[model samples]
Target: MFREVPVLPVVVPVAAAVFLILLWYLHSRDRLSAPRAAVALALCVYAAGVVANTVFPIFLDKPARSALWKVYLVPFANYEVGDAVTNILVFVPIGVLVPLLVAKAPWWRVVAVAAAFSLVIELTQLVTRNLLGGGHVADVNDLIFNTAGGALGFGLCSALSRVPAAAALIDRFRWR
Candidate 1:
């Protein structure tokens, strides 16, 4: 009964969007709300997935190690550290855009939204690994760091969203 989970983090959000769209199409009288929700949910999921994927491996007791050591090659590079750092750097955008993209998100509400997004990702990882025969172990650190990142991103977006220069820049970019 072990199902396989895809390695790519984006799959969860993409799948969610598809699922939401299908559900809305089948049951909803209002067509617009479904698509709107689908986009919002997908973005939230994507942001969470990015955070979870990046931060979880950092706190493992038996961290993912250098393959070179096993292969009898150079043993200096710690692969796990590299991977963790890369994950943090990679998810920086998720932290920023998810908040701004969210409609009418008040400053106080952003934290809750970020936390909710992080929770979904962590839970998904835990459930997927446990029920799907994957070796992944969910860690609490991932939840914390990911949520922090998302919160930071949200704050940055909120600050910039109000600035006239940033708005002008965005408009210029969108025009091109």
Candidate 2:
């Protein structure tokens, strides 16, 4: 049950302010340009969307459930295609953008960062479920599929980077 409360009315404005401030800071410091700012904004929006989707809609009433949080440690157990695909797609942008944004990001580093990001999200869900009524559970399959998606995106980025025209276009938007 991944139900989220209708709190975006407040969250969106706050997130927008934060994103604007960050973009301003980076631009003032000569670390960002118009195109780079656009890229940064896209990354910020994607990250916010992921967090919102995974961690919101808490169960404040604490319905007679045994525990406030739950985890599925069994990998690939009763895996659903929709869930797996969603998890993978959610992480694919991280894989593509990290390498594009960082000057020295290798494929392994991309994968590692994706896994760490997924771990942080899962841990947050665990804590938030207990403290704030979040209903999402940590699942090993999610972690696995998220990493796989990142890997796939990295491969796609790598291949695209090898193409002269594609590389030129990517370099145009690349921050580093």
Candidate 3:
């Protein structure tokens, strides 16, 4: 049975508020240009979407199962290739955005951050699944694939930066 969980209804407004605050603070500091503002907005929207997808549908009624094996440890042991691909794709924007936001974001740093983010998502899922309601069980494969996605995104960003013309364009959007 599916229970409606009102996640976005709360998430969207909070994200918008944070975005507005960030825009205001940046503008006040004379750092908010059109490009930076666009990036900030996009980041906020993406973050909200991530939270919605990763941590919601928390059915307050009850959990579907009480099994202790929610944390899936084996990689590619029971998942399709498509699931792996999708996980990678989901994190690509993070890989691209971090370097744009930070002046000297290395590929390794991007991968590390992505892995940490994935870990947080999994932990949240594990906790909520056990306590408050519906959440995806933790999975080691997700962590591995999400980090790979971050690396791929950083590689794409690096390639674009190598192009003189594209580099010039991207420079305008660079935060630092």
Candidate 4:
């Protein structure tokens, strides 16, 4: 039951953000476009939702981790397939969106941002579990996987942007 957290809770907000961004692109003419703002807004909201869902309970009175804490440094040492994949999948959009929204930014900067984001999540898990006593265990593997996910996302989006058709489509939105 614990592992069955609904994916919709996370995906719905992001999907909505994407839709709004498309709309904003269609109607706006300011230098600051919708896609860029949407990416920032979506990233913040998504990060918050992730931390809240993973560590804190939805209801005010619900129980949390509470005295149970663990950490895994060894990659795949105690792997749970679903959790690992889900972690990577969740961050992939950030990877893709960051580069797309900040097209002029260097690749290293995009990667650094992604890594920093993952690092924050891991640290949050550690701090909340130890100090507040309710959060998932912090794991280095998550950092690795999440970083890789971000990189992959950047790669995929970047490649797509190079394609003539994709480039034309993306250019219409004026993401840069």
Candidate 5:
């Protein structure tokens, strides 16, 4: 049953956002944690959506289309390797920024989140290809590289957070 299931990468973070928001509402007493979690969830979803939109079709044999039926274009050859590179580049920021922005998140937690995000995306592609007769092939490289990118992002964010100017800028964005 799982093998034939259609997985949508965009849906993973979307669902996560919805779940986090519901949890936040239910636990309104913990204002700090709830808000942080909500922001983290939103960032995760946004990053995932961007990655999916940019990289998903690179793995497809055919071009993905817009709502108006216009075909999307990839400047480079649409191939497995290109898809892998794009996916990794797209999600690294998610892995990095989420942890830095959410103060209490540990390094390990950030890694875990990145890994989960990558796994969900790969699984989604696998299921989508299997059920839809699409040519999208799930690549293990994507899982590795995407997670690495996220970890890299986390490190960058962590390092940047220490700079007084960067810290001040981030402080301005915090919800009151």
Candidate 6:
């Protein structure tokens, strides 16, 4: 799965975001010196890159509609383990980063953020298909898998927040 996943989409944005965060911390008068904020911002930007790569036709260099709306709500229909897993994994960072960035937000807020972001991506694909003439299928399966990935990320972060050492580390990342 790791080998099959493209690294550039995640890496490029993350690197740029981190560099920007470091610069912001160094130059800005604001006290946003939390390492966690930097990480969260980088992750969110990386997640956006992943979504933009997956949904938009910007990479294709042509205006041609190659996608149909995939309305299937069922799982495992024409599913490859790699693609299904990748689809979920792509959004996992969003799941982890959003909750980390927002202080004291309830767990459900993670789900809401994940769902809203996923829906926006899907809707973008749907709209661009008609307007730009080239985009991904706005599939329900992608939304479900992406939301599941986000929930999983939230669970992992929540569990880590319970650990003494991890909590201490998380605190170091906190904006305040």
The candidate that wins on TM-score is 3
RMSD of 6: 6.0
Instruction: Indicate the worst ten consecutive residues by lDDT in candidate 4.
Output: 56-65
lDDT of 6 by residue, 55-172 (tens): 5453323454556543455666776678669878887876668765677867789888888888888787777555455446677778888888888888888889899999888777
Write model 2 residue lDDT over 85-144, tens digit each, in one string. 988888889889898678879999999999999999898887777666677778888899
- The lowest-lDDT stretch of 10 consecutive residues in candidate 6 is 1-10
The superposed Cα distance between candidate 4 and the true structure at residue 170, in angstroms, equals: 2.3
Q: After best superposition, candidate 5 residue 11: deviation in angstroms?
A: 7.0
**Which pairs clash (backbone N, Cα, C closer than 3 Å) in model 3?**
none
Candidate 4 lDDT, 1-176, residue by residue in tens: 23333446755676667666655664575545555565556655676566656655323333455654567778888878787788788778767777666657566776787789888877777765665554477788788878777877878877888999997866654466
Give the lDDT of residue 137 in candidate 4: 76
| RMSD (Å) of each candidate, 1 decimal | 9.9, 2.8, 1.7, 5.6, 9.4, 6.0
The lDDT of each candidate is 0.50, 0.81, 0.87, 0.68, 0.61, 0.69
Candidate 1, residues 52-93: lDDT per residue as tens digits?
Answer: 453333222333343322221232233365544543454455
Best model number under lDDT: 3
Q: Arrange candidates by TM-score, descending.
A: 3, 2, 6, 4, 5, 1
- Of candidate 2, the 10-residue stretch with the lowest lDDT total is 60-69
Higher-TM-score candidate among 2 and 3? 3
Q: Where does model 6 exceed 4 Å of error? A: 1-30, 59-76
Worst 10 residues of 3 by lDDT: 60-69
- In what order do the candidates fall by lDDT, top score first? 3, 2, 6, 4, 5, 1
Clashing pairs in 4: none
| Residue-wise C-alpha lDDT for candidate 5, range 27-68, written one tens digit per residue | 574545544555656665676575555335433333343233
- Which residue pairs in model 6 clash with each other? none
TM-score of each: 0.50, 0.86, 0.92, 0.68, 0.57, 0.71
